[model samples]
Target: MRNSRRNFLQQLAVSAAAMPFLTFEQQAYTPVPHNRQGRVLRVALMGLGGYATRVAEAMQSCKRAKITGLISGTPAKIKEWQAKYNIPEKNCYNYETFDQVKDNPDIDAVYVITPNGLHHDQVIRIARAGKHVICEKPMAINAREGQEMVDACREAGVKLLVGYRMHFEPNTLEVIRMRSAGEFGKIMFFQGLSGFKIGDPTQWRLDKTLAGGGAMMDIGIYSINGSRYMVGEDPIWVTAQETKTDEVKFKAGVDETIQFQLGFPGGAVASCLSTYNMNYLDRFFMTGEKGFVEMQPSTGYGPIKGRTHQGALAQPHVMHQTLQMDGMAEIILDDSQPVVPVDGLEGLKDLKIIDAIYAACATGQRQKLSL
Candidate 1:
């Protein structure tokens, strides 16, 4: 009798599960609220560096997005990109002619993938051209410039989004969701490590005027952002220690590596290390009362691996930048919010934390976060 009862209960459970699948059409056909059926977003590439090349490739996969404009100082690069992307001469602009892009009706947005120090001026120029702006990470050389960029976009009535690729990545999003849903219970501590052995001391990345502070500004920002997203909270205070193994390689104005700690409101702590002197070791680990989640290669360019207390996620993969561009398109054209957080406010918060970390490093004292 017990065996028969168990069999009946199993069948009942299966039926219950099948009911949702059988009625899936009822849910599947629900129309999207934004009604962006035929709209297409036309984008402009403002820089032609390695990152810009990657960004251009990513835009190819966006259903409602296309690269319609090209802006480069080099005629060779402009001609090459125009030919490769099939962009017309009418949509291409050099630094001298870029000011005229405001009159060009073909472009709706301009992506600034230039060095960190160049972000402020380029963003302002793009905003003045009446186009939305998408800027690479660390938004600017400092928080003040970041604020100015935000203000310029607001004044121009065009949207501004920071290129935070992880926010649109599936594995990172999964970790964020798990944390938000309380799957990890009361969060206690987190750890993040982001590093890459930077070569070519003469590269733009080592130039203080072009790349800003150093490893912290370029790749260390990832550690700052990852802890914030995974913890799902703004930090209340920060403490940091800066180190430089090769003074000649790092130079005077740039940092080689930095180890930092952030204190959250509920006593949660995050310890992070950012270095340009080490081999690649991008990872994030979050521990809480109930369980924990870990991601290896957490902040690389693409194809982030994710696992949780539930299990490994299975889906056909895409480039992280491609997914981010697609999601940005949806947000711009379809009025859809990003599944992962990637808004101006989120970018500003990360900058605020970064400012505190810098202050702590310089003062050799714990800095209290203002926001």
Candidate 2:
């Protein structure tokens, strides 16, 4: 029982996928429709970090969502966001007391953009407050925590989504649509390279306790999740090997680099690399009997360029977070499902795969995955 708006988006996606002959001008300028309708989702962001600032900036262009409130432990950051976003004093609260959001009529949801370790408790609390939740990727430290958040949201009767912005990217969706239509027959392989060099030794991401791990927790999950969607199947097994060039900086539990392999049930194989000691490593490639797709600078912020055997992908490039927020608004308000899911279950699957990857790294053996 899909909603009307969801059906519309699906048909629009099909239309776009079918028209491969469309000129660059026509495709590049095809912006997502504006939100002129009345019901904008009032959202309170629970983090005031660098990424949160980016989301706030991007929300200015969002049609169906708006920043209505702020939650942070630092009063300085809260005041700064309040003044900048025109948030009233009444709509701001510290981490110690955000549960009072239940009484606030303006906010319909809370977007949790905090660190890896804090997601489980924070999301449960926000759900208990009777608000839908949109959390950043790698939903929690592991699948167990992600499942708890999912169950809490289910019990509280609220929608739980993850910030998998790529799921809504026009070019990415075009590829997915093509795959679903069997343009690429009998999938054979996928390769994802996601990484960047580490600059700071003191950031929370370097702290195993706060981050739950290192490069894998922060950036590696991209390749793990990418392999699933590109192959259009969940992996059944994973074999991994870890490398740490700087023992002191990366710590014992934190990983500096990991190369992992995924085995899909459909006889597809994927090779992925995740690292914190490398640069120029963002790419995804997949091949089948009929066609192939390659994306360089694949998962970066903007203008995600790519080409398939069909030709270069000409889909419009909106800010990833902007499209994500607007699409999430539809999911919350209209109960519409997007072309690709960004729900809590999707996030949990990624976590389950991550858990297996880490286990493989530790045991130096193939770890089986059921997700």
Candidate 3:
């Protein structure tokens, strides 16, 4: 929920002469109605995996959202979530019986937390079931699949939101707000490094058929998406480099580490890195003419810390997933758009960049982005 001071400040307009360099469009902040009273949005957790379990736990703290249904390939996991969340037997379903979810009025939406490659099909199925969808990031393995998911949801008249939780994170939003206020001057450059060492070599993420790619699809996307929003502009071109230390572990068609660069329309540039063989590299740094903002553990599931050239950010910490679920509830129930959008189109934009990055890496040449 947005505080009164911030709410009032968002409604205030700055003169074009006062902040000629700032993009006035990004400055308008939408305040969530903390006192909003309505029916709790019932969501079914699809894919009872690690992240899905985290979301389910966070939903318990959501004021306007509740986990009322479960869908999983593993019946044991489904039974666990059902008993833990007090979900009815009728709300439990496997992939074969998932189509029957269409008849369950208790469920208003399905949060697709499956692997990247599965999002396209499952999202379409959820839309066909007459339920809104909240798909995890990467939305799909490629832009084509992301667009299909978006089109299907639109055809079904149900909303499709991507689970880009960082967009709802407080500290990240503060940086965006500061950038929009001209505090960062004219944004000129961004640097993002996101990587983590993989533990299990045989995990589904290493399978190109399951993950679509390597680190880029799994965690590097944070750097890709962060560059766009932090710079407040779409990238016009991309150049990339891919390197693998162990061919056996990375396998063919999968990447271990990728370093990519994005050129924005204004000539502002972003240098990013994504890998699965490194640890504790999560960070984002943006610099404008006058000042800079820096964050360490930037995209982690945590108390993300950052400071601007002005001073320490001093922002309070909140669970990223908890804030995300509440913000999503408001988006679904009230038809309100968030300041940092997580809509399907936003997901598609990242996928387009990902596609370009991969092409650049493959061809050893700069790839143009239509987005």
lDDT of 2 by residue, 92-193 (tens): 998999999999998999999999999999999999999999999889999999999999999999999999988878777777767766789989999999
Distance from true location, Cα of 142 in model 2, Å? 0.9
Error of 1 at 194 (Å): 0.1
Clashing pairs in 2: none
> Total clashes, candidate 3?
0
Clashes of each: 0, 0, 0
lDDT per residue for candidate 3 within 290-352, as digits (tens), equals 899999979998789888898876677877888888888888887765766799998999999
Over 4 Å off, model 1: 1-35, 313-315
What C-alpha lDDT do the candidate models reach, one value each? 0.79, 0.87, 0.86
Report the lDDT tens digits of candidate 1 across residue range 242-345.
99889998998799999999998877999999899899678888899988887777888756765666676443457877777777777766655454456665
Cα lDDT over the full model 2: 0.87
Q: Which is the better candidate, 1 or 3, if ranked by TM-score?
A: 3
What lDDT score goes with residue 359 in model 2? 93
| TM-score for each model | 0.89, 0.91, 0.94
Error of model 2, residue 79, in angstroms:
1.4
